[model samples]
Target: MTLASTGTVIEVETRAGRVRGAWRGTPGEGGASAAFLGIPFAEPPVGDLRFAAPMPKRPWEGTLDALEYAPTAQRGDPGVTLIPEPSIPGDSTLNVNVFTPAPGKTTALPVLVYIHGGGYFAGSPASPWYDGAAFNRDGVVTVSISYRLGFDGFGWIEDAPLNRGVLDWMLALEWVRDNIAAFGGDPARVTIAGQSAGGGAVLTLLGMPAAQPLFEAVYCISGAAADVSVDEAEAFGRRLAEAGGVTPDRAGLSSLSEERVLELQKQLTAPAEGGNPLDGLRQFVDGGLTLGPVIDGDLVPLKTVDAIRSGIGADKPLVLGATDDEFSMILSEAKDKLRWIPSRYLLGKVGLTGKARSAYVAANRTVAKKGTAAIVGRYLTDRMFRTLALRIIHARGEAPTWLYRFSWTSPTFGMAVHCIDVPFFFDCLAADKVDAIAGDHPPQSLADAVHAGAVNFITTGDPGWPRYTAASGETRVYDDPSTVIRDGYAEVASLLPS
Candidate 1:
């Protein structure tokens, strides 16, 4: 599958029949050796097909166009800088983008598949920042995929399927398993990498029986395996039904307009009288829509934390962590509202109190800069991200897990912020078509270092950092020019409720 001819459309035989992808040139006017775009991994999930498990795309008779990307899942206009646009109605939404060195007779190269994150709400694999042309330049096959989002993807309808979005990801992985060899990719050596919600997906996948054979390693930027519980999900369904002016029955709920459904989802983030916007509707427990992973017997049978604690996922290798201030992005509007709430009160929600709560708050206060805003942001970030990272690491005793904290704040925003590590990790300083997720332009060296670390982990099981275990308790702190390895990020980890 190596050595593709540059500047010619190469016929790729997919399960959906033959498609002609543009032949990326080798060091010519354009900077690609070989690449493919807009490849369909599953059938379109639109209209009657929406909310259903992904079905195989029916094969075509002639060559299908693979030059343009397919439409993505629906998203509201948040007006953020680097995020991608939502898919247009009636366009096929289940597709993949693959970049590979011309399939010239080269040896099998490691494959890296990227899943975009937007809290299970927004994001598409076709975002410009995700262009894998550079990875192809280094002889690694890269893939980015699209999946259903919002109520269309995560709503918990009792009669309908659960976790349809997660199912989409699994189907794409299966496609790679059955077809990636034609693109010079070794399916057995695949690495599933993602950030935020996508990172969470990686953790859930590790716990999923159906997802085990798809990849050998995983790299999660700032997500966890936890999601909304069945009870909470049903409540969200009721909310959606209420918004639609109907009863909370499956048929009644499914009849609502997509726009109306999204409006209900937006309300999930709105400040409530005494409730956190993310409290019950958020992905905290397993099983239900709204949550991406459920404890369905065949898909996911237990909480990811429980599975890791029980040694169910010990054989799998993991690279996971978060930005130093991952919650800064989410708190942009509620910074003031967050000021007086003590970390103790928040920690109590997760069931820790007295000495544990006091200790956690004190530790966070130390690292947090002197300012109400800074401390609050730091506290929230630790509660959400660092706590989860430490939980997964502490609970799992089988796999050799690498842990890290992204500490460099983007100069543009003056904070590392949520999703700030993405562009640098992808080496996408100049990539275009960014939506809400874009960050400041990164220095070439910064992108190189981050991407190198990620690629290193994908190619080899190590990311040039120490592994976190009960014994050594080592950690990696990733910054602009250097990646430092040390021990005991417990100051932040300790803040998590037990």
Candidate 2:
């Protein structure tokens, strides 16, 4: 197989048309491969398309260039880091990036479709860290997808439906179902995985009736199944509409420019004090102007947790968990807010209690070197991750669930920070340049251990760890040296109010 770069192009057949993509080589030159980058899975939502449910892409005549990534969702930069403008055109912001070892070959390999995390406001599959080169080398076909974010993707309108971002995700999955086999992926062995908001998307997909049979398994990192209600989402949408000076209707708001819509989204997505944007920004489940799939009569008639509890998608294996210090990213908040500052606290005044407050304060004092930052990290970590994972693990269920804790500390971040463990799972740890932010190189053995667990899960439906059952309460802790820790943090879970 001939290795190539931007200059090389390969053609791929999609439901819309034959698309061209750039070629890249896997490490050690096992084979030549091609990746279709930035191919729009749905129609551009720009102009008259804004806030509308994702429309199917019209069939094209000949070949389309799939070489570059499309522009990110309307909100643009998710405030995490800078990313380049869309390499392709169109406003719907629905796109996918595919990596294949044998670009033109027809083989049904296991498929791993990835959804990016940007708190539903920001993030793109084009993030350097999301490179799929390593997974290509590992014999799996990988696809990274970008969907609408913020108001454009999730905002509600009195006239429009809910969770447009979710609709985009569903469309991307539909694209995968139709075209992945052409890239040598088994449509039946698909595994949907994500980090943070992306993880939340995974849970959302599991709860979606339309998303059923599209993915056989799901793996989530640092996310939970339940979030805002329909009413909450609608209220947020109303705020966005008022801010944008448009009626909360598709036709009215669709007239605005993509940038304007994105700016309004940014303005409204401000995270509450002491809460990460990912946790703070959510699709409201309210009844109007934001009527998304809710416990309403249609779409999402049941809560996700309830659906799972009743064996809705129990045939599928689920591997979900979070990092030990998932909140380290938000720990940089002001020192004053890190303390007994009740106004901005995520848990609110009523949630913090005597022993719990004392334990938090004492923990803060104990972490003297890091000062209030340590305390803030602890609070956000528990608020964002620990409680959610424990809730899912303990929730009554018979679906074979595997739970894990990403504890491997980076020389730079100390303990697996929020999104730290993602690259390792895709086996592209070295390609993402995360080492630069992580401050130091990760241990090689640690990479191997993490990679092994992911590979096992992808192939066997089990993550090579003990299954989590309410009675047994098993958990796999991933550290520099990994171990199976049974009920390691049960007390922390119990602390959250039932």
Candidate 3:
């Protein structure tokens, strides 16, 4: 490692070559850290590499400037996601952003590598919520990685590789193993985590036999798993190609521009032209993600839950959970309108009918009191995330697993909601737009509690909470005054089949 004359520019040597970064704060301050942004782990996935697996980046000639945020897979933003993920324009999108307090110190501190989520279609690693400054301030070296998104990344083509996004993740982890030590991170003591689709990504990696050597721990926040089978993936791919007037193979699909592919993807994914609003809810309930890792029986052998039950990642410690109301905000506009409809009728729209709907409502009497929209929204949250958490816990059996619930309702949104727990997890309350959802006086103490547990889990493998066991499903609830409760997911058990 070497520092330039003014001391702001820090240089470190990696297998690919030397790269330069800049200091984020006063050199000696406790919160000070160095950021190396847009460090490529693989060659640009363009031209001949367009629909193929990510090829390892070759050694560069001189000091590669890794100062600015890299181009992102998420092109032209759709307004803004719950997180402020920006889409910089460029082709070398497969990269990483590394933040560390000790650049040349050889400290070998524990590492935290985060993956961003946008339903396996859109998301960027450049979000302020994913910055590793906070983690670096706490003595943990941090990295946020980018992968191919949407059709170019995951769509199945005859000549193109499947799950290119998944391959990007593995190659990035390999980069961490080979180069993170240059940034003072321990190669062997790595912890990978993600939220939403990113959360699902970590869980997917957790169950892969080949990914066992990549990391030591996981924390899935509001995870939405996408175990799309090969048949389903190919079906979507063929439709997508047909929409673009091309063949469903790498050579043909790659002929279409990235923007055209994205447009076609939206067209296919959009709800039917005249379909009812409730149909959107059913898609999430019945359809897994349209584009993601396929059960190719090679890279990804089985569904994530089944793989976990078979004990692929049993040795690694895991902490996973969702907020009290993940997608309830999605139905916020319909609250007054939904009130006119019967709760049971609304439940029936999503296939919860007869004694089943009655039993579910009876079990969730508290949420039921919140009205029909709340019930439907809670059902969505449970069907996709909270219930999935329970399934994973039971599957692990005796594995070291901790559960947590981010129950802090956003003052503006009026429920915990999707992406709300992320700021707390990253300890980034002061980041852009946090006030829009959390209101003016979002609690810092709550962030302290949540981030403290996350840091504990990353550093020591235990999250300072009771392990989740089949006999007693203990869970940590992160509210203003966070507390532990046994069987925290009991209310969701009614959703389980008899």
lDDT on C-alpha atoms for all candidate structures:
0.71, 0.68, 0.88
Name the runs in model 2 displaced over 4 angstroms: 1-8, 26-31, 74-78, 81-92, 224-226, 271-297, 332-350, 355-372
- Clashes within 3 Å, all models in order: 24, 17, 0
What alpha-carbon RMSD in Å does predicted model 1 have with respect to the real structure? 4.2
Best by TM-score: 3
Those runs of model 1 whose alpha carbons end farther than 4 Å from true positions after fitting are 1-8, 24-31, 76-82, 104-106, 246-250, 273-290, 329-354, 433-441
Candidate 3 residue runs with Cα over 4 Å from true position: 1-7, 78-80
Give candidate 2's error at residue 4 in angstroms: 7.1
Give the number of the best model, judged by lDDT.
3
lDDT of 3 by residue, 1-498 (tens): 112223488999999999999988777777888989999999999989999999999999999998989999899984235778888999999999998999977999999999999998888898777878778888899999999998888888977778899999999999999999999999999999999898999999999999989999998988888898888988898899888999998778878998898899999988788888787778768786788778888899889899999999999999999998988888899899999999899888887888878888998999999999998899889988998998898889899999988898898888998899888888888888788778888898998899889899999999998898878888899999999999898888987766
lDDT ranking, high to low:
3, 1, 2
List the candidate numbers ranked by TM-score, top first. 3, 1, 2
The 10 consecutive residues of candidate 1 with the worst lDDT sum are 280-289
How close is every model to the real structure, measured as TM-score? 0.87, 0.85, 0.97
Give the deviation of candidate 2 from the true structure as CA RMSD.
4.6
Q: What is the C-alpha RMSD of each candidate to the true structure, in Å?
A: 4.2, 4.6, 2.4
Residue range 267-301, candidate 2, lDDT tens digits: 55544577744344221211112222334335565
Residue pairs with clashing backbones, model 3: none
